[model samples]
Target: MTDDAPNSSTPPGLLPAGLMDLLPPEAEREAVLVETLMAAFAGHGYERVKPPLLEFEDSLLAGSGAAVAEQTFRLMDPVSQRMMGLRADTTPQVARIAATRLGLQPRPLRLCYAGQVLRVRGTQLAPERQLPQTGIELIGSDAPAADAEVALVAAAALAAAGVPSVSLDITLPTMAPALLEAAEVPPALRQRLARALDRKDAASVAALSGEAGPLAAALPVLLAAAGPADGALAALAGVELPPAARAIADNAAAVIAAIRARAPGLRITLDPVEFRGFRYHVGVAFTLYGPGTTGELARGGRYMSLNEEPATGMSLYPDAVLRAAPAPAPRPRVFVPAGTPEAALQALRAQGFATVAALSAADSPKGLRCSHRLVDGRAVPISKEG
Candidate 1:
């Protein structure tokens, strides 16, 4: 081999940044993982639904979906000439489906979906603009038990995907906003408190809420209470919350109780101050993380469906789920020699071996990287002597 470096010119057809093509086994494994999650959701009574990748911009970005408006990719439809948007999230599309085609269906509709979504941007934690997501929506119920059901189903799906060491972080997106409203915190100070809480900065929270009264004073205390479920609940109990905020706390407690009943062994944490990544979540929300995974494995929360019915659901990122899954064993590949009879090769394949037939008469079963070779009328192991 020459010591000179190879040509480094840009290829004629390279993909855009933050987009990539999945190759071979990795792509196959991701497909398997998505199916596993869908099966898990189906087991919990969630029916699968498919929505088009693009839709009218107005409806797609309406209601709670407005939160993701900036992330949507917009275009002019060739037929309608109306502005259309490539979905950045599928939950809204599912909601639209529920409101229209499935509107006549009975209450408590359990729907699940698996598809690819395109976003205009990507965060540092998840650098891929295009992603595969699988999720379930529990629509038409506002009960706290609905929240717990969604959470439990999400955990079960992750477990089915071979990611068992997951930690679920539960939060109330409305907690800080409710507290600020209850405490009559001025608009300026509320913004400061929001920023500080988003960063989990206790000192700044305290500094901003110094003279805002006892309810406001609880801001720092709540910030400190972001940890294990038991401790966080105990800490929350001591904080004097206004009636609206107190109601939220009660709903969370109920959701926790229901989750404990369903999945007692799951690791759960509470972060009442975590307000990020839950733009449209109106109630209790959660994010799942594998033991050593950098970003969240999945996220879900309570929201309204079609701006009419109460709904709760969760969405899981296949890329992260696959990253956290156990490595799959290689498939058994059997290589057939060039002169091997077609009947013998068929026999090998019928026995569940992945047979690779030689293309030319000079081709032998050597160095093909297959696990076994067709010898005589049987697939036999390739010995060192061969």
Candidate 2:
């Protein structure tokens, strides 16, 4: 082969779309961010749990898991000859554990988990197929207080991860459906209206015929009502909603009130007609955003766990969190000359120095990207010009 020709035997560094390696400081930073968030959850009495990366297709896709079925990757199991699936989300598995193995634990189970999730594809906003998730699940509670607690804890965890100015946008996923059901709109019109509302297309919604009765009129108002929490609540109160939709609004108000009482300074907003991306949330749900972040930093809401247990939780995307979080300060690395005492290395490590021992006299500390060098068993700063 000519020297200019491509080498057939050489492997390329190309990774599959929506997937890439996390190298150096970034990988370490993500690990630290996960631990920091987990510690915050633990502080709030959320014990840690680890779920398997794979499970039987039936069990993995049961109940709420059905929401992500399209994103799950499935394969036939060799031993059982049954279909198995890699987890696309950890929340369902956590719920499964709460309903089965830990069913008898307590009335309100608090659990936190951190792990990697593999999805078949990615969304327009989040185009990464492999992502790290750190989150907490508060199960067996239907109280609005449970919702508030989860939101607050998630905010606190994000704060601990060094994300500043985090804001919560609360949404009533069921309100629109409840309104439509009460108005008894035709199926075809209902689907169209729903699509319009999901897209937040006010012009399209207004263009729809007013023949749907109260629902047709109420939807545009609800869409307009989305704004800062206080004002939106006032607008919702003015709307003459059906009994079921009214109840949902009331529940949302209560949850928002609880959150405000606990975290008075938290930035809160409301969207009464947001029915997209929350497939299984039966009650109030919320999306968290950090200043300068592209997409949601975390999201959670009330849902029915396995065996129909009431549950609420939040899942933080570490990739997004790392983006919003302040850049981590690089750790000091110290180079130790050859034949350095093992005890000296241990001492440096005890002081939080990342020691890089020299393999030979020719190995330069600067070449190894070390910030310091060990001399007489002490870490001495290395000149940048060296």
Candidate 3:
């Protein structure tokens, strides 16, 4: 066949560049993973909540912190003059619910949701911006128990996702903030230090903090203290924690201690220099990653008393979790008719095989490499070399 360059004449369906179609097996695998995570959160008393994927820009930005706002996909509302946006993050929504609607219901609210978010940001890594996110937000309760519950739920979620050997990168959001404030670091200098600390670039951390004043003097030592959970906390002692920072540290330690005591074998690392990731992460922000990876598999943190109209919560990046998920075994194939999936399913059931609607006719047996197909518009028979 002669090579023909693609042009605009190609159907719009064929032009979906940053989008993907998940086949039955992949979709089923994702469904299973989401289900498993939901169960884990539910077990810990986090009730399920479904926040609207589409919201008025005002509502979405109601209490969303600064950094999170940068990630939203802004658009104009056709029905009204108001600008609108797809929620880039759901934690603020969760926070609003807890502070307003759920205020009368309970002092502490645990809610989780699975939703699709469209990121306008260029997907340099994956070339796909829209993805599913299943996350939980812990609101109302500032107690260490709440943090522990979140940690436990996160670990269980990873296990549910079939991730092997999850190593937690635990950090105290208050640490860096606390250090900057106590050291009386200049606003300009603190910014540079934050970046260096995130990259774990010791030279940069020193260089930036070195000129900030007395605050920069011991900054290197404190940052170097980052390691195992307990060790990091110990190193923090020399850092001079104000009451707020001390409280943040105490809460984190309690959460970590409980997780270790309960699970015993789970590995947790502490990075005290870790700054707040999402602008909403006020107290303790943490991320979980497996060995040999630089990106976070799952991340969340505490943001207590965010706004008067809302409260505390966390948002799990389901897309990240999905990315980190091990490829599951192929789902058992069930072929069905493209025209009449019902008739085909009825026939399949009669033949003793459970069946579902066929997603595409391209899977017909006679079609290109179509290993699975509905024979005679019904009946499911997985071929094998018997």
TM-score of decoy 3: 0.80
lDDT of each: 0.87, 0.91, 0.69
Off by over 4 Å in 2: 1-12
| TM-score (C-alpha, index-matched) for candidate 1 | 0.92
**Candidate 3: C-alpha lDDT:** 0.69
Clashes of 3: 0
lDDT of 3 at 142: 70
lDDT of 3 by residue, 1-386 (tens): 33685554666567456667778666777777888888878887889888777777776776553456777878787788788778777676676666666768766667888777766664576567677777787777776667666766777777876776677777776677776787788787888888888888999888887687665565687689888877887876666566766677777778788778777788888877677466656666767785565356667877754444323444555556666777764533455555664655666567555455555755544343333556666444456541
Clashes of each: 0, 0, 0
Compare candidates 2 and 3 on lDDT and give the better one: 2
Looking at model 2, report the run of 10 residues with the lowest lDDT sum.
207-216
Tell me the lDDT of candidate 1.
0.87
How close to the true structure is residue 132 of candidate 3, measured as C-alpha lDDT? 70
Name the best candidate (by TM-score).
2
The root-mean-square deviation over C-alpha atoms between each candidate and the true structure, in angstroms, is: 4.3, 2.5, 5.2
Q: Which of the predicted structures, 1 or 3, would earn the higher lDDT when compared with the native?
A: 1
For model 2, what is the alpha-carbon lDDT of residue 19?
90
